[model samples]
Target: MNSLRLAAGAGPSGRALIELREVWKTYRMGKVEVHALRGVSLAVAEHEFLAVMGPSGSGKSTLMHLMGCLDLPTRGTILFDGADISSLKGSELAEIRGRQIGFVFQTFNLVHTLTALENVELPMIFQGAPRASRRARAVELLERVGLSDRLQHRPNELSGGEQQRVAIARALANDPKIVLCDEPTGNLDSAAGMRVLESLRDLNEEGRTVILVTHDAEAAGYARRRVQMRDGRMVEAAEEALR
Candidate 1:
């Protein structure tokens, strides 16, 4: 856990890449209503590695989804690079997500039928990138995540760690500046999870802003700062140097 560095006294970078202000999200499950977030405010600076830790049903995933542009806040504002995006329609948000943000999930979410390379190239394909260029970038990203040797393997053929590596590579396919991960290592063994965490740390060190949502302290150890959530609200924050 010593690898975790805290960004103490690090004020806002004059420009936060993501800013959430009094954001609240509510879900309707039949006649029941679920308040997933409660007046949560946060600011994520450029190239910062932040971990949001909370128990199940603590709204960690909802917060991640809001930051990733997968979902908008039910109330309040979300600003991306200072522009309000809280009310953007699905297509507009999708555009922002495709070009500006990347995502990794606990499930790895790889196309079981696609090879690692193809899975990594899917984002570029959606952006209409040239085939040759997409292939080269996908290869480069896979190698960056230490998955060069697994290029042709399908998700089913790879180990949990390998699949997660491929997912990381895919997240970088669009060259996004921000990466949002939700319980990324939740499904892996200790050794495998370490690999995933190291890969994420490398990405953060390379200037990509990474937001990790997880309940595991060991996994959160890879981050420089931590925000603890409880009952849909951020209750604690800390930053410490990695020494």
Candidate 2:
């Protein structure tokens, strides 16, 4: 696989929007202490598209959680837009996450009872946006993701690709600067997955920072830069190991 070579913790733009310095995450399962991340350090730039590739149990999801502000690191520093977020309170972290970061998942976690439009509007509602404004933004976002015709369809009414597109639209509802996607194409067929990947590429071209975590190299190809994780540590390349 072709890859870009750059200094560690630096992006094309030379400005780090998110930085993880000597980060470590450990989980305790009663009798055993599991280390999910081992002194990992990474930097994501303002509009960079980065892919984190790893096998199962490599701690890729744990890294995403930390980057998305969903959880805190057990040891080390996390900086968001030049602000150290490791010490931020839960409420403060939530506020930053709601306003500045968005997330997409492999499961396409949409509200089963809500229409596509309603699902897209959920984030704005959380931010206390006016109904009219949120609705308008949702419409724009859905259209942006090429879901203009399926606004009224529920998750079950749409195909896996369509539902994933709705999830992408919802992720953009709050106009977040950073989007974290964890195995977004895991459940789709090749064609559908390509379409979803294209949408993500478009979003990145439009200037939103995107971080994708996937084990599939095809998915990683959509990113401008790629990093590998192994046994809780970041490795420059692990293709041979993967094979």
Candidate 3:
């Protein structure tokens, strides 16, 4: 693996956009409780590309869910843009997620019949974005992610990499401040995976906060920083990121 910083540091802009303080997540699984996250604290700066690594049983997905506002932590504070979000209700959290965050999932999650342009425009349609503006923005994002030629193509008409790129374009439809991706390239072959990574790297370089969750070191290499987790706790490595 490359010598990526294993902690938070500077970015395209010197501002911290996401902060997790003493974050904890507990799951109630029958009589036994599961500690999915164990008091983890970290800062992800604006426009930074961060990779999270852990084994299957590790709390990587749990952390990503909390970070993406898909789930609330059982204990601790999550501050997005300097506001505490761990206490927000589901609706409030949804609004925050819709307005400020973008998600790229392992599954492309595209509507089978929707064209790439329509799939990308769904977010805005839900958010009540103006028709003209949403259409223009979706096209722009598709182009930005190198999908201009495929805008009118449906997911079934595209390749795996193209599908993921369309998903990315859709995620960016709201012009989100940060993008949270989960095993984004895990479904593709090596060549396709490389294309997806390059797309993510390009997005990060162009000033979008990019965070990826993956078990693959090769995938993590695309990030400027990597965070390792194990058994619900962050296994601190020697300091690589400048404190």
Candidate 4:
């Protein structure tokens, strides 16, 4: 396998929170093999905000999924905090993901029936946190994301941006050390998108390692370091890649 390594050295000086060494992800579809990632290697430092920018089908989302432990690579090594987790079972991966990583997506994946506060508290509830502590943390996270007034609102009752903010708050429910956001602002207007991006930046500032996968240049600009990807491989620079 050809190796494409991008050393993420420009961010905050600290141990790498996640590392992907010569990772490959392949899928089988009706006897045809699709290689989503091609021996890509990367390291994300603790508290760094790194953006992976590419157009559609560039394997950015696949990369994010592997980093987030949502899926395992077909080949190569993945390490979380210096421990190899690439070969872990699904339940073991879920345990680490729940405790240490959070995810935000293009579509706000909030439950329609759950109030904002309730949604934010859901992760903690699953983690078996006490009800009182979960509620308090939910309130604090909602307030932090400037959604204090919308705690009682359901998804249908809030704006797209508000819903996204709620998703962000919910991602923080377990106080995850790493936040993986995939096209977080894809569904909102400029103003609302800016707010969501600002919230992400604030999280990074507060010592959370944030990895954002986006095709928008403006969104990628919020990150401390940017890496461009193309055709399932990391590239150095291409102005048109984000277009």
Give the winner by lDDT: 2
lDDT of 3 at 65: 89
lDDT of 2 by residue, 180-243 (tens): 9999999999999999999999889999999999999999989888889888888774322111
Error of 1 at 63 (Å): 0.4
Task: Please give, for residues 134-217, the per-residue lDDT of candidate 3 as tens digits.
Answer: 999999999988899998998999999899999988888898888999999889888988988898887887888899999998
Candidate 3 regions exceeding 4 Å error are: 1-14, 237-243
Give me the overall lDDT of model 2.
0.89
Which model is ahead, 1 or 4, in terms of lDDT?
Answer: 4
Q: For candidate 4, give the lDDT.
A: 0.87
Candidate 1 to truth, TM: 0.93
Going through the candidates in the order shown, the clash numbers are 1, 0, 0, 0
- Deviation in Å, model 4, residue 186 alpha carbon: 0.4
CA error at residue 66 for candidate 2, angstroms = 0.4
TM-score, candidate number 2: 0.93
Model 1 lDDT per residue over 88-151, tens place: 7778888888889989999999999899999999999989999999999999999888888989
lDDT (0 to 1) per candidate: 0.87, 0.89, 0.83, 0.87
